[model samples]
Target: MTILQTMVSVMLAAILTDNYVLSKFMGICPFLGVSKKLSSSLGMGAAVIFVMACAAAVTYPVYQLLVAFDLAYLQTVAFILIIALFVQLVEIVMRKLLPPLYKALGVYLPLITTNCAVLGVTLNNIDDGYSFGLSVWNAVCVGMGFTLSLIIFAGVRSKLENADIPETFKGIPATLIAASIVSLSFSAFSGMI
Candidate 1:
């Protein structure tokens, strides 16, 4: 297939049937925590997107270099360092330019440094052996999927915030039930493409 065709397919799959957060179950912490509020979810999603994109760009070349030097086993360590540094850079920029968003994101901003979803996509790009352009596109798509899921969950939570629930399924239990329903809905997209 052509590069364009490949990228389009990757984007669709990543954002729909194979969403990192909902489908693959990576980065559930932020998915559940920041998703309590729409504003916080949006900010967290943007931060994750920036980190995922940069991590993909930087880690691909770094992994290639590691393989060249017969140090492939150290990729996990190298990727962690790369992702951590990139998250730090993003945190600094957000703090300066978007103070309110930075404040809202708060601990989640630093938490992205350890977010498995960021690391998962980076490693997934390398494992898939995608070209640089495809890797970047896949990363962006995964980030978008993450954002889409977060926003949808936040909307659900907002509505539930006002809804009356039985005592047994009040807080986290109710949220989990909602998340399960959402996840089941996403499965309908499995046959989409």
Candidate 2:
């Protein structure tokens, strides 16, 4: 396939067929935690997108350097450090510019530092042997997919607030059920590309 076709397929696969949260099941903590409110979800999603993209951009070159030095095994450490730096940048910006969102995100903001999804994207890019541009594009697409899942689940959770249900299935149990159903719906996108 041409470069354009490859990019498009990668985008679709990342955002739909292989969503990190809904499909691959990475980063479920922030997915379930900060998704309680639409505003918070959007804020967290944007932060994650920025961090993931930046991490990919930096990590790609860093990985190349590591490979050249025969220190490739240190990639996980290097990538995590890069991801943490961006997450800190995001945290400072959010705290200064949007205190409410900063407060809303709470521990989850710092938790982004350890988010496996962000780290996973960087590693996946290297493992898949994608070029620098494709690596960054894949990260953005994956972040979008993460955002889409959060927004949809937030809507569902809001509806659940008003729905009558058995006491046994209330709260976390109900949320899990909703998440699973949403995940199942995403399965339809599988093989579409």
Task: Name the candidate that leads on lDDT.
Answer: 2
Candidate 1: RMSD over Cα atoms? 2.0
Candidate 2 local lDDT, 39-135, one digit each (tens): 8888788878877898899999899899999999999888888888877877788889988877866446687887889999999999999999999
What TM-score goes with each of the models?
0.91, 0.90
Model 1 per-residue lDDT at 36? 88
lDDT for position 4 in model 1: 77
